[model samples]
Target: MRITNNMMTTASVRNINKNMERLSKAQEQVSTQSKIQQPSDDPVVASRAIRYRSYVARVEQYQKNVDNVTSWQEVTDSALSDLSDVMQQLKELVVQGSSDTLSDSDLAAIKEDVTQLQQTAIDTLNTSYGGRYVFGGYATDEEPYSMDADNNVLFKGQLISDFNDNGDEQAIKANIGYGTSVTVNVEGQDVTGMGSGNLFDTFAKVLDGLDSGDVSELSDTLDAIESNTDTILAAQADLGARMNYVSMVGKRLDNDYTTYKELMSNNEDVDMAEASAESATASTVYEASLSVGVKVMSKSLLDYLA
Candidate 1:
């Protein structure tokens, strides 16, 4: 085949274009600090980077869930602690009211204290966190317990069995990991005697017993108050366990997030030093290609004719 000037010029232009492309890619990597600016740059690396990024995002979300769970559990624990203190105070009042030496006026004063204690317990039961009732089961938007005009405690939340379609009275849960979740609440019935009966019924009865000077009934209320105190204690224990689980999961998620970030860096981020070196080399080669193309194009018969 005969060599032609047109063919030579075309070939030189193609080589210059190829060299410029390499140089451009190297410059992009150095400037952006990324191995691939587009998926087409390196499909395999880009795919792996995508997966690693997804994992990192998921770990971040799980950490957020763990944080939310911790907040809810902390609020629940604090409220339960308050309820426990109230129960203990009520128990003390019950014991004092049972004494036969107390006068009518003294009994009336004790009843007043009992009423205050009952109201305190009610407030504790209606505790809210982040604008949602912590003890309302899945019906978190509503108060779990309230007092009517007659001072009777009313249940305003879902039943334990009605919390979910599975009929399990599980509290609100947070997804902390793969196939893992933590319950972050204690239902009203579990702690405040909302479903079984009024936790403060014995408090009211003790008030009545004091009004009539009935020592026997006041003495009996001591046992009922003890039972309610035990219930609150049990709920606190459960909340503590859930809190522990959430803390452990949070730690694991932290470690996972660190690992995911490292993996993503390895997959997608460019080594600055190496990319700089490559960019320098590509620049030198591209300039040499331009020089060679210019030298070839200048050696033309038309130049001699001019």
Candidate 2:
């Protein structure tokens, strides 16, 4: 069988084309720093990379939720701390006001301090952070308290506010009690029991008695103020526990985020050493193919005569 010039030329052209294709593919792989440039290169690895990316995205979203939760916890803690301090000051005022030996003038002087303490409580309740009322829950734009002309307190917002971390309520545990679900803002009256004649209720009465010169009410005022202090302390304790819970959840979220990042790296990140080896192998194969093609093409028409 004779190998004609036209056939030799065609064969050489085919080998050169094949080598060029290999060279292009190797260069692409080197530039991309990936063994799998396209899905066709390694369909399984590509699919795994997709899943890993999705996992990383979800982890990032959870991280954002953790941030919000942490912020909420901080606000809760601040409010509770302020409330505790207010209770202590009110207790002192009640003690000073209870002295029967003091003149009406002395009691009247102490009443001013009580009024200031009450005003401070109001201010703390209406506290805002980042332009939003911290205790307002979802009513971020609204103040949680409003004072009447008669010095009475009214809750201006909801009792319970909703805070969700990661779109999953289970991820968050802001609410601690098992009572009626309050609105966005927990009313001072609701927590301290104003109508039920709790400690806070007695404190209000004591403040009124100071102006009325009702010396007999001073003893009861002291009792109520002390009791109310205890109640506020308990609520503050609950807030502290909730803060701890948020901290724990945040830690778990951070660990999960780290794990997800590592998984994503394993799935999609290139192995530099392995990629370089593969590129070198591809180069050698491509060069060998070119050499073989050149030798075959050099035979020419004389080789056919022999």
Largest TM-score belongs to which candidate?
Answer: 1
lDDT of 2 by residue, 1-306 (tens): 996767877987887788778778767767876657788888888998888788777667655655665675576557767877887877777677766777878887888887787778778877775677765445568876666676566555222222112232212223322221112233344335434455435657878888776767766676666676677677667656655765666677677778878877776667777767767877888788788878877775577789
Task: Give the per-residue Cα lDDT of candidate 2 at 95.
Answer: 72
Q: Where is the poorest 10-residue window by lDDT in model 1?
A: 157-166
Instruction: List candidate 2 stretches off by more than 4 Å.
Output: 1-30, 100-106, 129-132, 157-190, 198-203, 213-216, 287-306
Instruction: Give lDDT tens digits, candidate 1, residues 5-124.
Output: 778888899999999999999999988899998899899999999899899999999998888889888988999999989989988998898899999999999989989988888788
TM-score versus the correct structure, for each prediction: 0.85, 0.75
CA lDDT of each candidate?
A: 0.84, 0.65
- As for candidate 2, its clashing pairs are 158-183, 158-184, 158-185, 159-183, 159-184, 159-185, 160-182, 160-183, 160-184
| Model 2 deviation from native, Cα RMSD in Å | 6.5
C-alpha RMSD in Å of predicted model 1 compared with the true structure: 3.7
